[model samples]
Structure formats: C-alpha cells, structure tokens
Target: MSPKASKPLVPAKTDPAAIRNFCIIAHIDHGKSTLADRMLQLTGVVQPRDMKAQYLDRMDIERERGITIKSQAVRMPWEYAGETFAFHMIDTPGHVDFSYEVSRSLAACEGALLLVDAAQGIEAQTLANLYLAMEHELAIIPVLNKIDLPAAMPEKYAEELAHLIGCEPEDVLRVSGKTGEGVDALLDRIVEEIPAPVGQPDAPARAMIFDSVYDTYRGVVTFVRVVDGQLGHREKIQMMSTGVTHELLEIGVSSPEPEATKGLSVGEVGYLITGVKDVRQSKVGDTVTSANKPAEAIIGGYEDPKPMVFSGLFPIDGSDFPVLREALEKLQLNDAALNFEPETSTALGFGFRVGFLGLLHLEITRERLEQEYNLDLISTAPNVVYQVTAEDGEVLTVTNPSEFPEGKILEIREPVVDATIIVPAEYIGAVMELCQSRRGQLEGMDYLSEERVEIRYKMPLAEIVFDFFDQLKSRTKGYASLNWQAEGEQAADLVKVDILLQGDKVDAFSAITHRDHAYAYGVKMASKLKDLIPRQQFEVPIQAAIGSRIIARENIRAIRKDVLSKCYGGDISRKRKLLEKQKEGKKRMKMVGTVEVPQEAFIAALSSDEGNAKEKTKK
Candidate 1:
C-alpha cells in the first residue's frame, strides 16, 4: 500500500504482458455472476467459506432481483503455467437494455468470455452480444456453462455457438459455474486466448471512464481502464469531453472490495476519485488525462443514448416532488441511460416525463425509486415517439399527449422495431400468430437447427410496449427469447384516446392507440375503469372517446333507494307529497356527489390486467 496515495499500487514499470483485461458476456440467467464468484475463489482473493453467490453484484436491489443492472470491474492476481498474471475482470450486465453500454465499454477489454447455457442453446441476446463483440474486434472465447446439470447439452450448444461464431465446436470449452467443473480449463483459456493489453506506459496518461457512480462523501467515483501511461493521486486531470479540470483525490482497484492503490498504470482497470460532484462532468466513455500534460488524441466516446420508451413519473404525493427530484439525481449518477424532464399533467398535476431504453429499463428505474428512495410513485403508460405531420404541413415529434396541438394532423408515424425471436420449432406457429395479431409484418424466418428457428418481424413499437413480451412468454412456455432494435419510422393511423369520467377528460388515463384497434381497446378500458372506480350516489358514465367521438361506454348504475315507508295514518294525497319531496332531495344530492378516483386506479391504467406493460414482472 502506498501512503502518499499518489503512486501506483503496482510498480509503474510493470510489464503490460503481465495484465489481461477481459469481460464476461452472457445472456440473462446464464450464470455470469456465478462464474465470476468461482474465479474469485480460485484466485484465492476470497475464501470458500466467505464466498457468496454473485459476489460482484454489490447493490441490495441487484442481489434481490438476481439481475445485473450495470457493469462491475475487479482486479485479482493469478499464477498459471509457471508465470504470474494479473486479471482485470469486468462483470458486464446481461440485460438487453444495458447491452449498448456494455458494447461501448468493451473497447477497454482485449477479449471477452462468451458464456452460453448448455441447456438453453443459443438465445437472442447471445447472438446480439456476440455480434457486438465481433464489431469491436474482441477476442471471444465461447464457454459452454452449466455442463454439470442433468439436462445440460454441452455438445449441442457448442455446435450452435460454433456455427454462429465460425469456430470449431471442440474449441468451445465446457464449464459448470455451479460445481466448478472444468473451471480450471476455462481460467487457463482466459490467460492463453485473451491477448495482453497493448499500451505505451511512457506516454501521457490516457484513460476511458467506462462506468461511474456517486458517493455522498467522495462525490463521483469513475471506473476506468488505463489505455496509456499512468494516473497519480493529487494530479489535476481534465475530462476531454467536458473540458473540465479536477484533482484526483484517490485512486484504487476493486479486488472484490475497494482497496487503495496509489494510482492506475498502463493496462490496469481501477477507480479514479476526481472529487467531481456532478455526474454530467464524469460522463461514461469520456477521456481522462493529466491536465498538465494531456494526451494528444482524445478517446472517441460512445454515441448519446436514445431513449425509445417514454412515460410520465409522478410522486404519489405532490409535496414529495422535491424529494423525488433528489432521488432521481442520485439514481442518474449510476445510470446514464435514464433521461427525464419536468412536465405538468392536467389529471396528475406536476410530474416528469421520463424516457427509458426499453420497458425493462423503465421498470428497473421505478423499482429503485420505490425500494431505495422509499418514495411512492405513479407512472403513466409507456409510449413511443410519434412523428405527426399537421394539416398545415408542420411536423412535430410527440412523446407526451399533453404536447399535442389542437388541430387535426394529416399523418402520424409511430416507431417500428426489428424483433428477432428464437424459440423451439413447435411454438413457431403460436409466436407467428401472436406477432401477426399485433400487426407485425414478417421479415424473415430461418432454421437455426432442426428443432429451433429464428423468427424476425417488423412491428410497431407501441404494440409490444406493454404485454407483447408477456404473451410471447406465456405462448412459448418461457422458451422464447427476443431482441429488438428501432427500425427507423413508419406511418400509421393513430389517434389519442382519452378516458372521460363524468364527461371530463383524464389526461393521466389517456393513451395513443391505432385506429383499427381503438374500438376493442376503448371498450376494454371503459369496462376495466367501471370495475375499478367505486360507485357513487349518482350514475357515473365511464367512457373512452377519440377526440369527443365516443367509441366505448360503461355505466356505473346508481344504488336504488326504497325511500317510501308505509304511510300508517296518511291519505293518498299525503303519500304523493312525501314521494315528490323525496325525488327533489335525490336530485340535489346527485348535483353535489363527487367521484374520488384512487391512486391505485391511476397506476393500474398504465397497463391492462392481462399483463404488466409499464413494469416488468419481478423475476
């Protein structure tokens, strides 16, 4: 350990050949974290008794959800084949939503371990991430994981991966993340197959901030991989992107735990504490170098993230607005993909229109807010950006319904996506039927193997924004996996349908739907609302209308009152007067009766009872 905190933990003269920078890439639930834990145990960095599952997954929410929301980097030393080597392992996220960030950060790695489940064969994300690895020209070593299981089919999956990656099936190494079977071979392969990082230690320090998180006391701590030279403590550094300068307070590496390193040198991955408060200054993919002697060339950064799914997020209590804002800021420090802006809703009042990479990303953000920040939130239905060409020829990109102009639009174009689904051949017809029912156009279909097929469809983004994935899973018995990307834009007959209670539009319950499905959707929405809303003294009309053209209506019948009691000693004229008086009183009460809509109903309106569209089911 260096007392000065400005020196490298290892010698500055350490050889680049001794360091291997690699990341583990796998599809979700394919044992990525489990494998990393095994590596830690094998390296003697953590004892077996002290070891826990998913050791690198540090967040409580991440541990509970069994998902990796972000990437993590760690350094450990190992000796193999009579030579000492240092492994800088990056545990990348397995979700499709975070794949782009992982890809961009892959530039920092010399190679990647492509983990595939033997029983599941090839999946949509497996292929998707494999292509991304190839795009970056990463040395990908296919590892057939879960080989110890009774249902494991390592031989078959090896062939599937080999066919896709153009490698010999025998070259795919088999390992069981659970029982540690053949893990030694996998480790040896990492050192042998993955090349040493190439960098010039004599040159000026140049590092890429692959990930960053905010600490209350430390400000912003950025995780970086040194491309060249060395970074020292108390050194003034400049962010190439923001052109901002700051002092490096501390430098260290996560050896499964944060350990103080004097600084990071060439071919090393570690954390840099720059005392940066605003996360915007320490952006992911930004170049960091010494301010006194900066690098000549700046590292090319990743493209700005584009959020495809849009929804409004509001605190359950309006008084918690400021609290929610602070929570968002803190959360944003860990997630650069989350985009939000303040907006007002007539029905929900003050709130924000938040944008997410996908539906899963939307759900994760909401969960973090509720569980971590302890703030109750209400999120409106998720929607996609629409290009509206007005009657007067003006064009607008509408994300929120409140932003819609009052006039009739000549054309409204919604976003479309290229979706690839991989499932067993038996379920092909079911998936095809579901896609077609959602107005999907078949793009291509090909046989990956005798019993497996890949089905590609071009479908409107709005169609799958809510229940499509759920339906696909149910239809295929959870065997189907999907990957989607935005395919430019397409024209559609779209209308914004508003839910009216007592003839007043509720903006929070409004949604844009295709005109062809408006009748059925409207009828279902009106019916669902009628059931959710409590009955009042007067009959309340729950109607779904398209710009005042009522398409579906459901009425909540008023409770009948037997107000006339037996007239013991009164004549027929007295009974008539009593009935007339009771009728007048009923009319007065009807005028004053108010329908109080509960918070649950507003949140429930975001998705249908069939499936959760706005939120992902907790897996």
Candidate 2:
C-alpha cells in the first residue's frame, strides 16, 4: 500500500522507548541538507521517483542560496533489527544569525548529530553550536561527512572533533552524504546510540510551539513537539501564555511531506492547525495544552530572540506605507526575531525602522519584502542600538541615529560582542592585526590541533556589523570562520554625524560613529553627497557636522547661465554690469531655493553602506 493510504505510523499508543528525537548541527555548506535527503530515502518516507536534493528546504530562496533558513522537521519510520522505530529529525540552519532557530530546535530534541566536513574540519560556528547543544545537555554524536571527497581527511578531523567534544577518535562516525556510503550504518547508530525521549504519556496534553507560519487558506500552521501527553485532531487546546483557546482542525506529520495522522503522542513532532486567521494568536515559544484539562505549569525555557542590528525600511513610494506594514506583520508571523515600528524621516517620509539579528537577516528580509510583496524599498544604513545618558541622568534607548538626543550628553554606550574566530595557525598574526584595527581586545587563544587555532576577542558590535566578515575572509584567504554574541554595552567616545544639505539635516543620512573616526566618516559622506546631488540653480554646500561644529564640507557648483557670451567685444563696464546683475540673481535664488535630493541619490547613498559584504556574499 502507498505510505499515505497506509495506517497511521504513529499508533494511538506507541512505545515512547522506540522514538528518538534529534537534529543535525553543522557549519554552513557542510552537507546538512544532503544528509537529510539520504535519511528520507532510506526510511522510504519519500518515494524514490519523487526524491530531490535539499528536500527539506522548501523555500525558493533557500534552494537558490544553497542555505537552510528555517528549521524543518520530519518524522520517518526506520525498520532496524526486526523492529520499526519512529525517528523525529529536525534540520536546522548553520549560519550564526540563525543560531536562535537551532536553539529552539535543540530544546525539542534529545540528541544532536554534530556533522563536520571531513575536508574542511571544524569552524567557528561549529564550536558555537556545540556549546549550545552542550548547554541543553543533549547527546551529541560526532559525525564526519563528505568522506567521498578527494581531499577528505577523516582521520585528521576526526581527532580534532573528538578532542573538542571530549570523545575518542574512534567514536566519531564517518559517512559520505553524496554517495550514500555508510548511511545505513549511520541510521542504525542513531537508533542504538541516542536515547529515547522520556515523558509522562498519561499526563495532560502539553506541547511546545517551536515555530509557526501563516497559511493563506488554512490560517496559522504551528509546528509543535508533544512533551507530556497526546494531542488528538479536533481536540480543544489553549495557549498557556496568551490564554487563547482554539479547536485543532487538522493534525499531521511531515514525513518529508505532510501526511495526515490520527494524533501525535508524547515524544512526537508534528503540525497543528487551528484555522485561526490572526497571526498574533499563535506564537513561537508558547506552550499548548488541552483547554479542558490543561497542564498545571507551562513549558518555559527558551527566550525570545533579540534583534542585534537596526535599519530603516522605507518604501520608495510614500503611499505604500500601509502595505509595507501588512507585509512586515505577515513576515513576522514566519520570523519571530523580526521587529519593526512605524518611523518617519524628513527625507524619506513614512517608513518603518526594522530590527534584525544580523546583516544576513537584514538582507534576506529586504529581499523577501521586495520579491513577495512587490514593493520598492530603500533601506537606510544598518546601525546598532545605543544607550544614551543625558546630563539629567535619564537613559534613553536609541535605535536610530536620528533619535539621538540634542541636549548635553553625558555618555553613549554601544553594544559589544564576544567574538570567536577559528583559523589556520599560520594566519594568526593577520587575524590578530585585523581584530586590533577594529578596536578588539584580546581575551585568549588556544591551539585546537597542530595546525588550527582558536582566538577570542571582545569587540564593539558596530565595527563588525558591515563588512568585517568579508575583510576577515580576504585577510585569511577564506580560511577564517567567525561567530559572535552580544556581551552587554560599553561606554565609548561615540558621536552622531549628521549630513546637512545646505543648512538642513538629513535624518536618513545620520549615523553614530566613534569620535576617533568621525572626521573620516564626515569627509566620506560629504564627498559622496557632492558627487550624487545634482548642481542646482544656486551653489549647495554639503556639510557633515557634530552638534554645532562642521567637520567636513563640499560644494556643488551652481548651474549658471552665460550672460557674457552675448556681450562679446563689448566694453569692460558693460560686461561688469551684466556679471553683477547675474551674481545678484544667483544670491537671491540661493536664499529661497531648496535643494531637491533625487530619490536615486538617496537610494545609492543609503545602500552604499553595504560595501564588500554584499559583493562577497553574492559570489
């Protein structure tokens, strides 16, 4: 019989001991998705004729970029040693910005497969994710992937991986995700090595909503992991955090593809649909329980992800403000970390100041907005949140540089991060020099093996927000990997630089920068504006200023009419009279004329902040 038409794989009361919940954790481009495809095939969840690569990556962007953005869960039935075992597998994103997704997935699993590329070995994000898994106390099974590669160094990296995880080299499993070599053995190991989930199946129905996305036809689809009891289709449930109740309309599992199931029991993962249209009703990290006999306590361990970078997202057309708001609301339903609020700029008019986890997140969000919503947008230069303390002792949180206080300021604190960099031993000097140039303070260093070294530094978040990763890659020849986390705020010599056209400040062009580099920033902005802004009827001076003092200035020559051409061979007095008259007219025009900045100029100048990161990522 076809899998879909067969009886529910999850029986009404299956043995919890036969279920193993786990997720794959690795660095970017390390074959996480490739391995997932192999497992799905081996389990027969997806028919061979219908199989495709990166099967779990459903979004077009994910397939194009060759990166996993969202965490995808699947349930597969494996027949091993004369018994059928249900495997709940979650494939997570490896990028540092999406580490929050990995954390949420980790909370719902009992084990993690730490996959390391045999050819490339361990990276910065590898250690960062390892720490996260360790924090959750999950059983980590080290696996070396890409054993089929010509440059595969399984023995070398196996020892390195084992050393980091405090395991013997022999314990690290080896497999080629490309050719399916040793995949069957790997699946058997998963069943033998990983422990089954433990929970009270007879208790009140409780599940944790790890993720949720809005469906246009069916409303909100929530992905949950049953923690203590069984959740049946058509059962009434209540969200513990919000106290909102809804009846479950459909319940199913994604066996590489969505298939209807009778219900999900403890130690199982599946999707729940309540047919609710409001996106706010279903939230990630919220606990779901039976409305009639709800669990006594809510499942509360994970914290909401905080946005580390802030940028203003303004539609090119002013009338699209409401549409932009709606797009952001729907996007937020899919991305819990995204945050935005209505903001107005004198130059850009109506827009929203959006917060993102990092530069990658910002870029992805912008692309989705333009592609899916069909709205033209102009994004301001990204910045970090700053804490400003005034002379009156009141602290103000400033997400946009335009919101910087005008009065006397006591101190400005910028967010700092604890950065971890892993590179070859030969490039240690280049890495250290680059870090020092960005105002990084050395914490410590350690040699993971004979050739690999790990360096730690505490650096300001602003320094690395733009093109720091690109620079590091160039300096180290694309061998260095980086991961960082916010480590509170540090008081610094920071000042807000304002770009003024004529005498008016352009709030969209404002930025908060270190006092030491403020002059250079001012000069760059002044010169850039000089080239972008067209010549007006009267000379328009572009100046970059700090409070009352101008640090840099440039002038756009006026477009003057030639009155002297008509006075050829005339007396010097006649030419002088005509010149004076023209000069007087120019002065009057300067006094009343406003400098009109073209939308193209604003778009170019604002997006210029992206620099090398944009180019490097594209390649």
Candidate 3:
C-alpha cells in the first residue's frame, strides 16, 4: 500500500505540530532535485504523467543547465504513524553562487537533508552548506544519495558523512533518487527526525516573506512562511519594512502546483498575490502583517548579500535601457542578491554596473535578461571591488576599473576569500601548485579520509574571479570541489591599466590588475583590441599604460589611399610635394580623428570568450 493518501492531507485549521518544514541541501548535481521528484511522487502531489525531470526547476535556463538556480517550495502530504502531516519541503540550489538562496531557505525551515553523493563522498560546498544549516540550529538528517550508481560506496561515504555531522554511520540513510528506492522510508524519517515549526498562532497576522517574484499577469507574487496568526484572502496586508499596504488578491499553497487556499495560518507556507505591480513593494525577508492590526515587532530579516563580482551590462541597442531597467527590477525580485546602478561608458554607451555574487551569477543573470526580456546585451569583463586609500588619508571604494583614483600614492586593498577545496589525496600536489600560481597562501590541510584531502587557502578575489575554478577542476581531473567566502581585504600591489586609443582613454577597456601581471594584461588587451578595433582613416595607437608609463602598445595602421597611383609620369619634385601634402593631411587627420569602436568590437572584446579560450588551452 502507498504511504500517502490520495486526497489532500492537511485540514483548513490543521495543528502546527503536524507540519514539518525542511529543505534539502547538497553540492551541485548531488540529486537534490531528483530526490525532490521522488518525494513528490511518493506523496502523490504530482501525478505520474505530469512528472518531468527537475520539476521544481521551472525556467528553461535552469532545465537546460541541469542546475537549480532558485529555491522552490512545495507542500507534500504524507501519512506518518496514522497522522496526516503537511511537509513543506524547500529544494534549494546547491551551487556556491546561489548560497544566498539556501540561507534564506534555511531561515524558513527547521531541518535540512544533508545529502551526499555516495559515489563522490562529501564535497567542499557540502561542508559549507552543512555549516550554514548548523548555524541555523536546524535538525540535520544525513542522507547518502545515488546509492544505485556503480561506483557508489554507500558504507564508506556513510561513515564520512557520519564523522562530519557527528552521527553514527548506520544512521546515515541511503537512497537512490533515480529508482526511488528507500525514498518512502526517508519521508517517514523526515517526519520522525525534523521538528515541527513553532510560532504563536494567537498573535496578529504575521508572515515572513522569504521570497518574491514578479509575474506578468499577477503582479508581485510573494512567498511567505506564516510565523504567527492567520492571513486570509482579501485582507489588506502591510509590509513591515516599507509600511506599504496592499490587498491580498490570492492566497494559495504550491502542491507542486498552485492550489487555492482560503487562508494561511501559523507554520504554513504559501504564496500571496497582491494587486501591486511594483516589485520593490514586496521585499524578501520583509515581514507581512495585517494593515489594520499590525504586528508589534518584525522578524529578524536576512543580512543583505554582499556582491563579490561587478560587471557592466549594457544593451546593444540604447533604446532598451528602460526595458533593461524594468527587467532588472523584476529579476531582482526573484534574485535578491543582484545589485545594480546606472553608469555611463563612453565606448559601451549607457548601462548599469551590475553586481553579482560570482561569475555564474553574472552569466545566469545576463542570460536570463536576454532570454526572458528579449534584450541584446554587451557585458564587460568581471571585476572585484577594491579599496583605494589616497595619500590624503581618505579611502575610496572602486567597483569598476575606470573609477580607480588618479594620483593615488597610497595602498590599494583588494578583497580576498578563504577558499576551501576538497579533492582526492593524489591531486594535492596539483591543487597546491594551482593555488600557489594564483597567489594563494596555504592556510591549512587535513585528510578527510584515507584517500580524500581538504585544503584551505586564502586567495585574492580578483585572482580567482576569472578562471581559477576551471583550472582547479582541470588539474584535479574534475575530482575537486571548491567553496569560498569573503575574508575581508588585504593591501596589494595593484595598478590600474588604462587602454588608450589614439591617446584617448577608453573607460570600458580599463582594468585593475596586480602590478606583477600589469604588463602581461596590458599586452594581451592591447593585442586583442588591435584585432577587434578596425583600422581608422588615421593611424590609431592602442596603448596600455599606468600613469605616464606605457607598458604595452599596438597600432591599427591607417587605410592608405595611394596618391602616386593616379600620377603615371609625374616629376620627382611633384611626387615628393604630393607625398608631403599627403603626410601633412594624415597628421592633421590624426590630430582631429576620433576612433569609433564598433559595437561588435566592444562586445567581442568585453565578452568572456577570450578568457574561456585561454582556460581551455591551459587545460
């Protein structure tokens, strides 16, 4: 017999004790989504025919990439010990860039399924997420997934997971997300192990908005976890953060699908649709309360995510700026970590300097904007924030290379991160060598097992922001996993490399690199611009320089129109005079000539294609 009933499990006024709120946390491609599908099937929330791989991953980009970018919440019904329980399961993204989403999900849940791939054992990100879960004091249910794989060492990994989580080896549950073996028992274990949420049911209506998304047809759809009291449909709700009130047009729970609910009470998770079209009004981590009877205190919200990578995102067509703004506003509602501000580039035109958590975050955001909003965009090279201390005893924050202070005769501090890498013991030498090459300082190393080793390093953010991860994976033969967090900033010998075209500085091509690599960076950039920028009517000198010192230079020779071609039998003096006239005209043109860098050139030069190609060649 099935473990779950065919009908809806929870009543309208169900007791809070019967609700179990939890999330599944794992490393990238560790079967979190597949396990989620199995649970939904076991609970019969999604019928067999309607089921698809990565059901929780709704966007095409997510489905294609086979990675969860957003945390999806679903309510499943399970019969545990003759009691029908409503399980609010949040399947979170496992990538390091999306850790902010996991953190937000943890705040709403009481437990997390710490899933380890039995074939791969524990990874660096797995440990990082485990620490986050522990910080939240959530019950940790150790789960070993992919047990059916040929290389799966369930017993070995079970012990590894047990050692990490301070649990017994046998206590680690084994399950195959693909075949659905042992999933039913895992569900029952969730009921037994995870605690029910605790909230005051008698207080004024209060719900914590963990996430919100902008819907074209429905306006701003906010996902909230009811912390106390009850919120019903058509009630006027006020945002505790903004004090803005709006009518709740719809209230419902996602049983893998949006099913209308009359109201949401304490400990229940549901979505709310307010008539307000503005995405800013419904903020994530904001408290929602009844406008008439407001709650006394707001829930402690999540700390704002600090953006680690900054890049310029400009529309290929200038007219799409407003559309890009609207799209960014909507995307921000979905991804709260994304930050942007208006900035103008002389070469790239008007655009926004967007901040992302990492390279993947920047890529995903750009792709989403292009795919979802139908806007063509040109993105500049990704960079990390730097602190420039001037000789005047003032510190300035620089996000873009163009903003690097001029005449700065003081220290430059660059952001650094404490990076943790887990790899096979044999690859330790290669990993260490790669780290050292990127100016990484070894902090510590430990043996996770007889064959697996964990290495910690403190590295500058700018060094790894480009291709460090790729290099690590290549050096380790894809057996290594990495996780990192900001470790403040350290003073570094850094210089800003400015790209000048015909003696004019191009802000879009400027970059801040370590002093040691400034020459190489300048040379490469100047060479690339020489290939990208077309030959002008006058000779254009592409120079990469630091202050008055020219480190590297490339020249785009002018398109010469032969004056002698028209003169068949001219006198030598006449030819000389004509050549002199031509030379003088060229000099005059060079003086007044303004190099117009084509849009394609800007796109090609700024794109990550060259960097990726270099990484590929290294691999």
Candidate 4:
C-alpha cells in the first residue's frame, strides 16, 4: 500500500519553459535521498521541523531499509534571479535491483542530478544509471556530494567522474546534501544547463504514466508526466495502449503529499484519479489521452517488462489458496512488473508461478505478502526462463524445473547476460577468479583510473540468480559493484536434477544445473538435505537424479530406541528377546512410515551449498 498523504494544492507556475523536470541519480547510500531532502528544504516545499530523513520515501520499508523502492515526484517553488522557478523533482532509487524504477523516473524528466559520493567516488549502479540517462538523451549535471565528511576529496572524485562520463572536471558541481551547502548553486546550474521540456502544448493530451500505487480510498493513483496538451477535470480519458476509457475524477501533483489541482498541462508531473478500480488499466508507460480527440499514435516505450527470475509460491494450508490469491492480486495492483499464474507441484499442492524482475524484487514481494496479509508461505528455489527447442524447431519457454519436458528432441537454451563489475585495482584478480568460478566468460577489462578497473563478462542467468552476488561480496570484501543485462539466449548442456525423499521425487526440491557439474552439485545437495531433514522413525534415503541415473545419495538416520535401558545387568535371554521384539516392530514401522519433509528442508535442498556445506568443493 502507498504511504501517502493528501494536502491542499498550491497551483504551480504552468509556463513550460519556466519549469525544470529532473531526478536525482546516484549509487546506494551515495546521498540521492539526502540530496532530495536538502533540495525540498531549500525550496521551502517542506518546513524544517516537518522535514525528516528520507522525506521523499513515504514507505516504512523504504525508510527503515534506507533505500527507495518507489520513485517519488514533488513540485517545489524556488526563486532565482528575481523569478520564481518551478522545479518538478523525482527522487529515484540508487540500487541495481531497482534500476527499472530509476529508468521510469528518468523517463519522466528532461534532466538528472548525477550525484556521486565524495568519499566513495563512483559505483556500479551509478554507471549503470548514467548510461541509462544517456540512452534517454537526458542532460546530466554532475554533482559531488557529502563534502562535509572528512574523507571527502571533491577534486579527486570530480576528475574520476569527469574522466568516465567525458566531461570537464571544473564543470562538476559540489554540494553537502547533509549540510545544505552548494544546493542553491546546483539549482541555478540546473536552469542554465538542463533544457526545458519540449512538446506541443496545443496537441492532444498525452501524459505518460510513469509510476502508480493503489490507494485504499481512491483506487489507482497514477503518477504521470504531461508531455503534450493537458488533462481536464471531468473529461473522458482513454488509455492509448489499452483503449479503455475512464472519466477523470481529479488531477494533482505530489508535494511530498498528494495535492488536488484543476488540470495539468505539458511539463507537469502529477497524479490522477479516474475512479478506475483495476490497477492494470493504468500501467506504467501507458499513455493517457483525451477520449474525444485521441492522438494518432500511442506514446512509445510502453512495452511490458520481462521477469528475470521465477519461483513457486505456495500456501502452507491448501484451504488458504483463495486468500493467497487475493493478497497477490492486491500486491500486483501497484507492482505492474510482478507476474504470476496458477501452478501445481506434486509435493506443494496448488500454488502460483510468480515471476519477478530480479531476486531482490522477489524477496520484497514475499515479505510484503507475509507482513501485510499475515499469511504463511513457502517459496521454491528461483529459476530463469529457459528456451527448450525440439527437433521440429518448436521452441518453448520454461521457468519451472518440474515443467521441463523429457525427451524434448533437441537442445536447451538458457538466458545469458552481459555482466559488468567495477572494483578497486587491488581486488581485480579476486573478482575475476570469482566470476570465472561461476562459469562467466571474460569479455574484456578496462582500467578506469589508476586505482579502479571495470571488468566485463558473459554469464548465465541461472548462475546470477543463485548466490553470485553473495559470493562476489565475499570475494571483494563488499567493495565491488556489479550490473547485468540480458543478452538473449545461448545453447547449454543443462539438466534437471531432482531430489528424492524415501524413493519419492519431491518436485519442489528440483533444480536445473550444468550437466558436467550436476553430479558434484547433486552430492553436495544430497548431503545438505540429509542434515536439514529431521530424523524419521525409519531411515529416509535422499537421492539426486538426472532422468533415471542416480548421481548421489544420502540417508537420514532413524531415531533408534534404547530398549535395553530398562534391562538389568547381563540377562542375555531377556536382552535377546527384547531385541527381536524391537526388530519386528521396526520392520512393521518401516513398511508404513511416510517421511514428512519440512518446509525448510525443501528450501535448503534446492539451494547451492555455500555456507551450509563445502562450497569450495564446487570450485
């Protein structure tokens, strides 16, 4: 749910050229949000006492985690050179996982404040987003922040950033977002450097929906950027892509609070209420235009996002399926990128095959489900979409291992990605070794500066989904930044390895791994499962198999009863009789014993044995 507030609207100065639309871009903890707070404070959009840390981040999860999961747009009035300038600012996330959020935020703006930490220099996310901004043809104003810190060396970092982005180091602006220094000059530079919004105001209304959230009282509150014409209150509007129409209820902008306005024109960023109940009707990237006088062409860049990772989400109680479905429906209303459909596992019963942009996105969705709805859930191991080609040239995309076809005539093509890592020169060797161990092919290496290097590699999406980031952090001492993008598909020698509990294949515990390394992984996984699964009354055999070939096996020892505990010293006949009786009882129990695998066991068995087992063995 959106943690938003409603307030009165102070009409913004609507002249398109007098308005500047921009967003703050930086690395995580590189002062993106802090700089936004300073800007809001300086412009008097938020009072000093009313201002708090991460004032733009309204979500409790966002503030507690010190990250921006959602992009926030606000309008502020600031006077410079005897004229009041209206600034439409977007505060974007700085993490690689939320790169899509940053992209959407940038899509709404004509310029971006390219913030770089004065002490940390530049990072992976910083470069990734800088490239994104360049792709959007947005003007970037380089700003060095956190100069108040003792470790800050603005001149040195400025040169580094200028060298990478190909700008003059002297042109870089310096600021202390924490201390509110150099903020005013930065605002002045935005006007002089960033271009004004360019669009035909007399044309049909064309506002791009950049972000949205479902409100408990208002339904879908779509955040939009007005590129052409204007949205009038009580006018019938149409979604350019969906062709669905809705009556406009109200229009407004965010001033860190939702404010109602009569109408919004070109160069304005605001939210709209259409009285629409379905969130899917108003999606990000969809264009809102006048129904009566629709535009000739739909706004560009409205394609749906592809899910990078997929997993099974099952309710612990089978009766809770309806409740789980309702919860997912509500969550998906706000998160358009989230995809799910009904799926069933032999062991997990009925569930949903949920797809997410990345691992972190999946993690956040699950936490919200459990926390917001108070439901118990189990998630299977994450996997990526695989292309399975038959001899007849029939290609099918598969995300679940249980759904992987047998005797599918031809090769399996797995998604591959072009990965980039930025690290200190000293740790280059270690980082390269770690990447190589994950089956990454070294593409190239560049010396960004005397002390930093940028390494590029081609890696399988499966490897990236499973512990690659954690392993990289371990090797680089958390000093390296990694970024990746899908690079189509490649043929691979892959196999589905299934884990069997007491001779029964547990579909939820299966995974796809490289054929050559499957046996070793199978062995590690079998042993790990043995440790995780509780001891049953009878021995439970844990096995990993590829097709009918069993690659590895382990057994969970049974809980043996000391029947002789009550026996007196050396009564051989009595001891023998008791042992025979116990043996008979064990045989009977073994024939009827059904090992119940715990939920945690399924999670542990399907995972790569990193910390729980000898991860070095895989190397």
Whose lDDT is greatest here?
2
How many residue pairs clash per model? 2, 0, 0, 0
- Candidate 4 Cα outliers beyond 4 Å, as residue runs: 1-13, 391-393, 559-592, 603-619
TM-score per prediction, in order, is 0.93, 0.96, 0.93, 0.92
Off by more than 4 A, model 1: 1-8, 566-594, 610-619
- Model 2 earns a TM-score of 0.96
* Each prediction's whole-model lDDT (CA): 0.84, 0.91, 0.90, 0.86
Enumerate residue pairs that collide in model 2. Answer: none
**Which wins on TM-score, candidate 2 or candidate 3?**
2
- On a 0 to 100 scale, what is the lDDT of residue 145 in model 3? 98
Task: Write candidate 2's Cα lDDT for 321-363 as tens digits.
Answer: 9999999998988888999999999899999999999999998
- Give the worst 10-residue stretch by lDDT in candidate 3: 1-10
Residues 1-619 of candidate 1: C-alpha lDDT, one tens digit per residue: 1234453464433468988898898889999999998899988888878899999888888899999877888888888989988899988888888876677668789899999999888898887888788888899999999988899998888998898888999999999888888887888888998999888888999999888888787788888889999998778999987789999887888777777666788888888887778888988888999999999888774666789999999987999899888888888887888878998886677888898988889888988899988887878878889999999999998998767667688999999999999999999999999999999999999898898999999999999888899899999999999988889999899888878888888888777888888888789888878876778777888899888699999998777566556778758888788878877876777677767786666666655553553243221
The candidate that achieves the highest TM-score relative to the unseen native structure = 2
Q: How do the candidates rank by lDDT, highest first? A: 2, 3, 4, 1
Deviation (Å) of 130 in candidate 1? 0.6
